[model samples]
Target chain A: MLDNSMKLEFPSKSQNESFARVVVASFAAQLDPTIEELADVKTAVSEAVTNSIIHGYENSLGIVYIECEIKNNKLEIIIEDKGKGIENVNEAMEPLYTSKPELERSGMGFTVMETFMDHLEVYSEEGRGTKIKMVKEFKSVSIKE
Target chain B: MQLHFNVKDENLIVRFTGELDHHTAQEIRNKIDNKYKNDMLKNIILDLKGINFMDSSGIGLIMGRYKTTRANDGSLVLINVNSRMEKILTMSGILKIVKVYRNEDEALHNI
Candidate 1:
């Protein structure tokens, strides 16, 4: 019973990360989420989009697909990238483990997404692509002020 | 994002406005590093009052600055950290290394 849904395709560029966050946050705004909740969603979305750009595409040009759906108080977000896929997801998900450490990455992207979202699922095949599906259920809807 | 720098004694106070994320982290890092190199500042005080949003990249930025300050035998402190950002810092194990204060006055007094 989805109230509304959106799918966006943007270049795998660092600048587009902010654009992805804005789109997801704005779409989730209909849930009447609090400022903190909205920030959480924005941060999670930013991490996912950044991972796709930095890890998936590795600076090469590609397309990052983002799909967002809202059903009741629950929001589902899916970010996909068709580029170099993860060889070992478990290692990639480890804290402080980044393939591009020279880039000064903290390697906490997936951890932050997991912490902020209610549920997170990662699916990838080497040389294929990676798709991250995250869900967040708002505790209580706020009335328009 | 907008960054304001104020030097007091040997301390450098950086006030950040707007979101801090991967997109803006590199520019912010370069700016701070350049300022640190050219100025005689010993300590850094990051003012987070104007920052409404920050992701894990923010943590990396703080950590990198902390290392640079320590290398120069100086310290890095944080001020005006909202609860949301504080939570992220705490989770990332940054609070254990960096000191946090309520305002610039307190940070300046201590640093």
Candidate 2:
């Protein structure tokens, strides 16, 4: 039984986006993901974390929390932020429907997550927060020596 | 993130050697826009060979540049995009709008 999990809490700063991505990718590495699979997890994590820092927290400062778990050959990640939540998750997920066009947002965050991860779920409430849970399963898992 | 700029003919070729995401998009955009404005290049070519990772923010950056370049009556093209980045760009359906070339020379010749 190889089940491992970790938690992280950091400021919702734009710079932390890359930090979060790298951390989750490192955790998922335990499953022996391929280069492409690793890249996929990194991209998905980046998107979710960016969403929390940008759309969720907006201009205000808040905390971004991340929890990662490994079970079997699947990696599960949950990125949550207690900031301004999405009014409509469905509309937000629609590709190219950016609410911040002035900021040059392509509105592909949710789309990218769905594309890269095996499963994706988003939960949010106005004036509350947003939580994104994503999972990726490695098809070829090798036991470590 | 670092952006290396070079002017060839009427094109402004920018080589990006870092990850492209929301955090670095603004700085990179500002630099490219400044160069494009000052040099008055007729076309913009992005060399993505050095980019290791990207997200939707990269899409926004490219789209914004495409708009600015087109407004100048110019064109914007991409070169050396790896397979991983290609997958993200493909999902954005941006490949349909902006052309991608195998290399800078090919891009320069075609555009």
Candidate 3:
């Protein structure tokens, strides 16, 4: 059963990355997640939001949509951007492969998300946009007496 | 994020407080690089005791500094990494290239 959900839309700017991370972490707090779990979610959220700002919009102004839902012990996050999408996700996902090396990007955005989350799915069309959906299950759900 | 730097011998110790994300990585990189260039520091010791959060952008900042230090034949070390930041650094394979120390004294001694 879906107990709670929230959606947020903001400009694809670097500053908003922290905002996204805090919002997601605060929402996940209701699940009584451990500090490590919260940090994992926050890190994953920051990476997704940063990608949307840098790669999706190419630093230009665009909208980034973030939707989060909690079902039982699972937390699902969907980040979508309506901007220049990826050409080849496989190549993009490769570690240390960055289109904008000049920006000093490590090209580990997707890899970090994959490592910290239980499941990650990315969908993109070159001219359209990119959507990243990730899910993580909370392991420390507090039981009310 | 706030950054403070102290120069000891040829080593530059950078202490970071608050979050390290894309918003602050570029600024931090520029500041550190500028100091490195101006002072010709040979080693960099990153004090991570106050960093509560970090993302991939933080990794890029460290890697960039590592390259700069290597180019100058210097070294970079990390100290006081909390468990959370440790996990991120470990997963990113930064622990392999950059050495981690439990205290500033240890890092300075090795550098």
Best by DockQ: 2
Candidate 3, CAPRI quality class derived from DockQ: high
The residue-level lDDT of candidate 3 at B56 comes to 90
Alpha-carbon lDDT of model 3:
0.91
Give the Cα-based TM-score of candidate 2 against the true structure.
0.98
Q: Which DockQ-derived CAPRI band holds candidate 2?
A: high
lDDT of 1 by residue, B5-89 (tens): 9988888999999889988999999999899879977999999999978898998899899999999999999999989988889
DockQ of 1: 0.76
Among these predictions, the greatest lDDT belongs to 2
Complex DockQ per candidate: 0.76, 0.92, 0.86
Best candidate (score: TM-score)? 2
Name the lDDT of candidate 1. 0.91
lDDT of each: 0.91, 0.92, 0.91
**Per-residue C-alpha lDDT of model 2 across residues A1-145, encoded as one tens digit per residue:** 3899999999988999899989888888778889999999999999988888888999989999999999888888999999999999999999888789999999899999998899999999999999999999999897754
Candidate 3: tens digits of C-alpha lDDT, residues A24-77: 999999888998899999999999989989999995899999999998888999
> Which model, 1 or 2, shows the larger TM-score?
2
What's the TM-score of every candidate structure? 0.96, 0.98, 0.97
Off by over 4 Å in 1: A142-145
